[model samples]
Target: MAVADLLALINEVILNWIRLHYFYWANWCGLSTCTTRYLVAMAVADLLALINEVILYWIRLHYFYWSFLAIYPVCSVNDVLRYAATDCSVWFTVAFTFDRFVAICCEKLKTKYCTGKTAAVVLATAGVLFCLKNIPRYFTQKPGTIIDNMPWLCAMVASYYTDPGWVAYDWTDTVLTPLLPFAVILLLNALTVRHIIVASRVRKGLRGESKGENRSDPEMESRRRSMVLLFTISGSFILLWMTVVVDFVYYQITGIGNNLNESQWIFTCVGYLLRNLSCCTNTFIYAVTQSKFREQVKSAVKYPLTSVLRRINKSPS
Candidate 1:
């Protein structure tokens, strides 16, 4: 677990730093401003998720046993913030998917809906809504332990399991997150793929490819690049979150809260592990799918060593 924490911490910090710089400062990646904003938003959300979900939780749980954050009200607030970050990270991917779907399939509407202004508005609206939605989560926590007249750690209030309101909220929260995002991304990607296939055939016919005239179709090439970027990012997200999606269904159907058997316990833990891992994967996806992104990453990597060498050469030795 310590190693896992260290790796996650390192990955989130380093990769997101690189991603932020590449997406924000460099236009070499050839992505539109709207797409850049979505990527930046996702990176920021992933960093916050790592800080709240992994770093802060780790300190409270293991290293700093009596940390104030583990206390009742503080713990509840932490839980709320964590959920908000997770929701933002998950939904940003959905936003990016929908943006791509519009650009690829709905050409007429794309000009209006897929601008930087629209991206900002959509992200702000979603962020505020999710933050507000998760406020009720703060009430669902209780002290996990009482020691020397002090409450420490957080546990779900018993009523969260039994009360109708809390139960319904729980279901809604789960559905609003990975489950709904999962379905929506899959549907959007499916439609996008179908559109690409039909469009490709039409394009080849119009270009005289059926009569054996070979030519470079710049339009199709552009669409292929967009499809590559879209599919890699969304595909990584779906694959990583698949376990969590399944575990949610299992938990709801079985209603097995505390008495999970060995296999079930492991399964639940693995789902959580993968969910945390999802926060660190998009930078890799970008590197894999975008050649310009790879060039930028390599330059970013070499800049430090290059700077040091330049400094040594200029020194009076």
Candidate 2:
């Protein structure tokens, strides 16, 4: 069952604007803590995913008025973009997890590893790597049309059964997309937690309560809160990504096609909702959990509206 078009469109708009605003605020404030480039890259990935979703919904629609639409070239292009965006989005989250890991667990190396330049280099590498990885998608998914319940379907012509590379590729993506990232995130978060506990005990054991040391405690607390925010985001990611991974893993291993049974259809619907919902949620998490982020959002929202009002008030009637 497809999501209603109007609701999907509304989701696209809201996700797009809020993320764009967050990006602008992060940049404009020159916030060392928040302006990490991975966040910006993640925003771009989310928008790309949202746009791909809109295009996918449009392509999936089978209207009686346009029964003879030619999809030979377009479907392959759409698949390439969709695959690329999905890959980039997942890898960006992985990069963020690495960022948080270095920041919290490896304090001695944090200055070297967690800088903005380093983040940019990592994000760029991930983008290029995933784009190259999904290049085969463009070549393999030849476009054609098939009739489904009298509605023509823009379909891929690739066959996983005949092509061993296609089968390998599907399995590789399945591992990279969810399994590896989830494992890495869990491992890194655990390490970070252990480091925090050790550091807290050391601080408690210290004899001198210098003014500088006292001030640094708040900074450590702030960093811990940011780590918590990352934790929530990763948890959301795992929740959203698990079902699709399971569905794909099951299909590839068992060669069982989803024939729109009640269970399978429900699985698909939940996957779709989770995938899109995951893209927009980080911004909300930031807003609710990060006080600094909330302040930036207020300024981002206030200045433009205030300027427009001032312009209106000064204009001659």
RMSD of each: 6.3, 7.6
Q: What is the lDDT of candidate 1?
A: 0.85
Q: 16-99 in candidate 2: lDDT tens per residue?
A: 765675555466534464344666677778777766764454445543324232354555566677778878888898888888
Weakest lDDT window of 10 consecutive positions for candidate 2: 62-71
- RMSD of candidate 2 to the true fold? 7.6
Tens digits of per-residue lDDT for model 1, 213-267: 7689888888888899898888889898999889989888989866789999899
If scored against the real structure, what TM-score would every candidate get? 0.85, 0.75
lDDT score for candidate 2 against the true structure = 0.71
Clashes of each: 0, 0
Clashing pairs in 1: none
Q: How much does candidate 2 score in TM-score?
A: 0.75
Candidate 1 Cα outliers beyond 4 Å, as residue runs: 1-19, 22-26, 211-214, 296-317
lDDT of each: 0.85, 0.71
- Name the best candidate (by lDDT): 1
